[model samples]
Target: MAQQLDNDLQFEDRFHRKFYYLRLSVTDVCNFKCTYCLPDGYKPTEKKKPSFLTLNEIERVTRAFAECGTSKVRITGGEPSLRRDYTDIIRIVAAQPGITKVATTTNGYRMEKNVKEWREAGLTHINVSVDSLDPKMFYQITGENMFHKVMSGIDAAFDAGFEQVKINTVLLKNQNSQELPKFLAWIKTRPIQLRFIELMQTGEMDLLFQKHHVSGVSIRNHLIANGWLLKINGKNDGPAQVFCHPDYMGEIGLIMPYEKDFCQSCNRLRVSAKGKLHLCLFGDHGVELRDLLSADEQRTELISRIQGGLKEKAVSHFLDAGNTGMTPNLASIGG
Candidate 1:
């Protein structure tokens, strides 16, 4: 453990875990603030864009990650498409030395115009967050009435011929849990994978989490009763345990963060919008890699800092055991 821990910082850490996935947040801003994620009725437009890193700075840091054997990259944000140069960032990151796949998770509001452009720029995977299909419930959870707009954006992604167009549904109690079967039926014949994510413990999220948290186990039981088959180790892009019905064209995955199932094969690290590198999802405030990258430090120095951060990653968030606390706001952390 000490041998690899002291030697390489790109992927493998002191725990002997190799990290290949990178979650890069471009903008901390989002068009919609969900009920569980934001304080009551938050509006993103009220704030100015925070100090986001330049594309060139991101390029340098991404290059450093690639040098350390980071192969998969996911571009996330409040909504990654909100950035003016998101397409350019996709092109640039996709062109990096060791980076292979460049994917984005979006709310799908601003995705209509750029799906084609982004697909052409080496974006192979797209995950759209659609928590509830009902307009009223969607608005209640996301504080946005544009449910139809997000659906259209999903269609556009398929039309644009991206390799995968997936739906990420966060299962909040009383918000969308009862609608799980209906939502599953809605995707029966579509060429998109539906993933149900358990809300992570982040920010001042405990009160809301206490009220709204639904376990993935219960959701899976409900889905199974609805006749969804558990495809053993089914196809998935990330950590979600995937499933599917005999009738559906695409699969379903459950990102069970609350299940304490992440750390064993954990393969990703996150770079927050402000340039903090998170070795674990519920990790403490990470080293500010943006400061180092912006200062024109050599790639070796940046990698060294990343190595130092990786050494501190907790074995797990230990959510129910009270070992996990809210991370920085989900929007900033690109969750």
Candidate 2:
């Protein structure tokens, strides 16, 4: 039999897939009802009180993954900033032995109040979802008129000393598509990296895509036509195809999950807020880590489960064929 790898040994597939990145969703509660993510006037389910792995539980899981050679962890949520004890959680995860990088993905609603605290707690980076620069369009997309607040939050994050702050804009056809150039130009004036994402099918947005689909190819062409020189500069594993303008300080990135599939090189695993280990974003089925963690089994089992999940990872996500078996929204998955 193969000698059992040490709990801290990093595992990879035949293609050298380093399973070091862990995306952890800390909660599923959000203050915004983005039209793409949630239906208008949509109410969260009260039946199942939003469940969260307690700080101790999160730390335990983090250590387990770290033992399995996870070097980076990103805290995400419906909006991670909304979680009451989020700062403590960040501090705890950052203090882990093998974990080198800690980051968070937020909607930027409450960032102003918490960015500094998070930075002090040892957060290294942040990614804020800002779909539109227009206040009206922002409200329409998020179902909230907190555009000014989010922008303020971005500034606060910068001031808080976040090393790499990225603004994620989901490109929607006929809605925010026309403003791509303007958005890119505005972000260039700041130190933020602007990432244009191809709207994905998840949660309520899957239905919207059927009606109005926007691909990254179209956005690239639009940028090229507008006289902005675009070039692919980064490696493929980073999700976003990075580009730079000759005259700008900041860079632009296009994430084409639909037009281009990066599953072949996928090296990340997702751990939901409730402790389910997901191998693929489009995967409906996930291994229940909650039960294992609750059980008396030692950390060995936890490491085994994660390694098993990675070994069983699918070759590719069947998203192009319109087959994402997942029902939870991106917020639930910690995009």
Task: Give, for candidate 1, the lowest lDDT window spanning 10 residues.
Answer: 1-10
**What TM-score should be assigned to candidate 1?**
0.90
TM-score per candidate, in order? 0.90, 0.90
lDDT of 2 by residue, 23-64 (tens): 889887778888677655435667766678888779888888
Local accuracy of candidate 1 as per-residue lDDT tens digits, 1-335: 11222334446777787777899998777878787676553345436646787898889888888778777789998788878999999998988876777889998997777788999998988989898988998888888889998888888888899756888888888889888668767777776788888876666776787888888898787668878777664112468787777778778888887665576777789898778897766775577887678655678888888988777887776766755544756776788
Clashing pairs in 1: 202-326, 202-327, 203-326
Model 2 CA lDDT for position 82:
78
lDDT of each: 0.78, 0.78
- Minimum summed lDDT over a 10-residue window in model 2 is located at 1-10
